[model samples]
Target: MYVLAVLSVLHLCCSSPATSQDWPLDCTARKTIPYHSDNGRLFREDDVWNYTTVILREDLGLIVLGTRGVIYALDINNINTKKASVKWDVTDTQQTECTYKGKDQEIDCQNYIRILHTIEDGRIFVCGTNAFNPMCDYMNYTEGQLILQNDQEDGKGKCPFDPFQRFSSVWVEGELYSATSMNFLGSEPVVMRGSPEPIRTEFKTSWLNEPNFVFMDHIPEGANSPTGDDDKVYLFFSETAVEYDFYHKLAVSRVARVCKGDLGGQRTLQRKWTSFVKARLECPVLESQLPYLVQDVFRLCPDDDWNSCIFYAVFTPQMDSSDYSAVCAYSMHDIQQVFTEGKFKTPVTVETSFVKWVMFSGDLPTPRPGACIDAEAREQGIQSSLDLPDKTLQFIRDRPLMDQAVQPISSRPLLVKKGAWFLRIVVAPVAALDGATYPVMFIGTDSGSVLKAVDYPADNAADTFIIEEVQLFQSSNAIKILRLSESTGHLLVGSEVGIVQMPLSSCGRYKSCADCVLARDPYCAWDLTSGQCTAISSAQTQAKRKLIQNLQDGDTSLCPPSEKAKMINTSFVMGSNVKLKCELISNLAEATWYRGDNQLAPSDKHHISRDSLVIPNAGSDDAGMYTCWSTEGIAGHVHRRQEAEFKLTLGTEDPIAPQARSASKGLVGLQVLVVFLSLMLGILVGWNFYKGHFPLPCMQKQRQSSIEDSQADVPGVLEPLHCTEDKTTAPAGNSNNNHTDLANTVPVDGHATEESSI
Candidate 1:
């Protein structure tokens, strides 16, 4: 039974064929951008190395890249030109001071630039972990050069002191909101709002417990609010939670928000956030119902308000050894609801001994402590969050975490992968055939590949279709960042080695109409006029453009029919091996075999594979008109067409006989008898003519004479027959049909002769 089970599994793996629906679209990069200098001879000292951050400045047509100890500003219009790069390096004095701090010169002494955010004055704010001592500076563009500003500030919470530590920050309205470790040792972590008077969460375990920040974004005012609300900054991170009953701490993904206008509390939480509230983020797998750990989150919105914003997050299994990863999407409305109506978890003393965390059911403060200062609050003579009463602020500080968790848009993930670990995901809207825009997600994996997919609205939810998988980098380096430029129709891929400029759509990669249509990429279409697969936007102007596409229904009618294949005929001897080959044009189409009108199935004597059909012992029963079909679609309503046909003929015996026989012994006996009867008839006719009468005795005497004459000629015929029979006989185990035929014929001849005489 175990052997049979193993054989069954092996058969499935080996015999499973590739079909058009099951085959994944594969693509390659059009161009690659390397971090190392192309013109090393000219600019020996300048090298754009270790690209940790990539920022695109569309207004200036420049791509600013941050690396260790230096910054590079490349021309976005043409990245290959060497003269277009502007390099800015750290000063020698700063490097000397960084080295004197007893940090590793090679690893930690050099600046690991991590922060690159745009400021209000058209300048860029830059920060780096300067040899474990964080520092910040400004970059201004002037006369084709990026000049570093003289003024510098303490990075602290704005940037991580350790180069390898995870941190996230966002700049909104000239202020930077960041989540990072604020110390050189990397033990003190904080989420703070820096610039224009810095204020942060209380430095306590209750606020942040060993949190690893992933992303930060802001939602502008008056977008989804019925009563115009203040702008809000959202931070996404994962941290060890204290609410679980297990002995070990459980890791939980969190969505923390703070009012942009928050000015701290007046008394109880002075100089600290009064509107900081966080909730758990849940993304569970549909099959296992296990929540995945959130690795990265990307907010897809350009407007000031998050009215149409959706956050796409990459999650992996909680187990470190698991290779599964998934992508989940959360809408702004659901996140807002979780923050507004969700209950809070607060420490409460129960029964006899210990204090435990439970849901707070007491009456909340009047102005809603965790809410931003609104116009009504201003009208009530409350100037800022600072003027709010201590009771209202104390409720927010004590109950930072909500009891309810924020759920994703769908119960299951948008896409799930088995072997690849997704590190980043970005979504962009692409125009479809019906003038409708659909969200296309680009997921970056740790193995240097990107998977592009589209989500379409189905019955009551969305269905995901993976468009293509593209390999951007030759090396298997992790894709740390992915940014899409809608205007240029290109994706900016950043890795530890360098930054890559990849076009979002590679329509020309598809060679056939069926492949183009089956890919289901909204950005691409098969242009019949040009006989090529090209970008949809480029083919829109062609008045006679024939596009073969059906994203929803997967219709392939638009594709041209495959050319008719010629028929093939084969002949094989009985008991010999035979193989019939079927050449299929499309690997995506399913191949099947049919003998005449009946379908043929694989059996012990016959084997059917993806490309060929084999018969171990060819017999007369196997002779038939066989046909090969190429089919698509599901069973019962499949679209099938004949691809090739074969006429098979099986011979009864081997064409090359060992020995030859002129005539069989039975034929020789019959010929001799006919000659003897003719002679006897001649003699009987003469006697009848002479005597003028026919006598029965004379006839019998003539017949006896004819039989004796036939018997005399039989020995001559049987002599050669016996010699031929001796040669035909073989070993006892061998099969000899010649001797059996001769033996059966002699008996039949004797019976016929005896009946004739009577």
Candidate 2:
């Protein structure tokens, strides 16, 4: 087992800076909006519990939040506007039993509302992990209020017993299609649909083995097909691969489909899906065979054009610990082609050791195994799935996986982030000023920040620009959910504590045309008429105004010339320091100072920082006109723009007077004469010490006593001034002569004090 694991690990390893992904061009949000309370008071952090689920009611202009022990309804335009709320709590008996099972009474024993699905007639099917025993109900919204209809429905199959486990649900025609575990331990993962003759996937490793569902939705295939096909309920999830030969438990991304009109088969697949088929969703990695695991998925299908349906998903590596995440896109046409024409994969036990999964190349049956009851099947006397032959049903039950994998659009990821683990995604198609439709994606990350990017699909090129990243939460809490409001052009983001609503585009944040053009956001452009950066709408694009936008390559030729700061003349005192200021607002530009076309060198005399240039000990040579130039690179092209300029002069304040100059000359002469006199006095003392006098011995004794007394008070800066108190009694001739020589020397410079002891 150890050797096999090592070999499997060596099979594929993600290379740093992989060529399969594009380089992420980073930008930051110019403005951020945070949540506030509606009652004109600061919102308490604990007022709202963990936001587990969200419902985007675009029709009713409301956004509903499912939290612990309560559900809130707020205005879609403003999340701070609380419309209504409904509280639902569990009993003490249920909490006590939950704690007895080794769960925390405060965290796990509380009701964490997880399921919030919009039903018909302004009603929502709500469910929660009610203290380890799931319960569900319905609630209606009318007249700006949410009222509970009932709480009697058992939520075993509809909601997961563990609140933190992964699951997903979608409602179509009053029946909820959910993918979750059925038991408390959550060992059995199933894709169950609500009543009106309910059916679920088979509880087998080949069917829905250890799946973690991220998204589920249905598409009306009957309306689009000319042969009267059944509608499809698609599921996007990740599960342990049952068709691999690897040693480790390899997780593969899957796109599963089931017909909505199907019922259980007669003899085989009893009360289980007869048309269940799943295929691996492939996202090509550079020189690697393994695909990334699906974390979240968003389906964008236009109401006017159903054939233009696309599925955007977030993927992360299955084995690595890095925060490596990617975004991949798929079209509905490719997904349908794979499911309709793909081969079957069947498992074969080899050598009585392990099961090896291989593609089944044998001939298929008439009225294909997993085909919905279409016009061709009806012609073969098959009106419903139950009427199919037992051989056909058995073939599909055993071979539930399709051989051909569903590849992403352009056969690669749209965008990849090395440092961000994307948690949720919402994409909106915005019309650019160039008369083309671009998809703008708002992706949430693990650092409480939201990244906004634009995808330009031109000439079969996958050019993406990360326009901005906005921090929605004050704390470092991961954003759990994201919802886009088309009516109000607002984005609703949810973290652990609160939800905040912000506009999709804040073009006003860009103060200059150059800054706006460098952003490359599809929704923003520079207007020449108003001299302001404004949001570009479809109508504005149709009008064809003087909107300066360069999505393919950032071009600023049409922008008006910027006005550089006027040169201000200033005089600095001699030997004083000066700093010249050059303020700029461009984050992507580098500022440099120049003096008369020669770039200033940063040395001991001149220091250059981010916003200014400092000159220490200014001199006449340093006096000159200086200019600050900003160099910015946009779309692989570099451009220089002048920001500010200044003129400086290094000079004295005023000229000296004639009388003061004369006084300074006199003082210099006096100092010179004092130095000459001190030198003569020292020479005379040396001559006296060389020739000893006769009768001056009596005078020498008196001088020695006087010198000894004065030595105690004299400073020791010139020579040895220390003497023993009994030196007079032992008096040596050398010691007396040394004291007499010191007394003859006179002090100079006058820096020494008379009252000092050595």
What lDDT does the true structure give each of the candidates?
0.72, 0.78
For residues 281-341, write the lDDT of model 2, one tens digit per residue: 9875443455588888988886545578999998877766434677889999999999889
Deviation of model 2 at 429, angstroms? 1.1
Residue range 690-709, candidate 1, lDDT tens digits:
34244243433333443445
TM-score of each model, paired residue for residue: 0.73, 0.77
Q: How accurate is candidate 1 locally (lDDT)?
A: 0.72
In candidate 1, where is summed lDDT lowest over 10 consecutive residues? 715-724
Clashes, model 2? 0
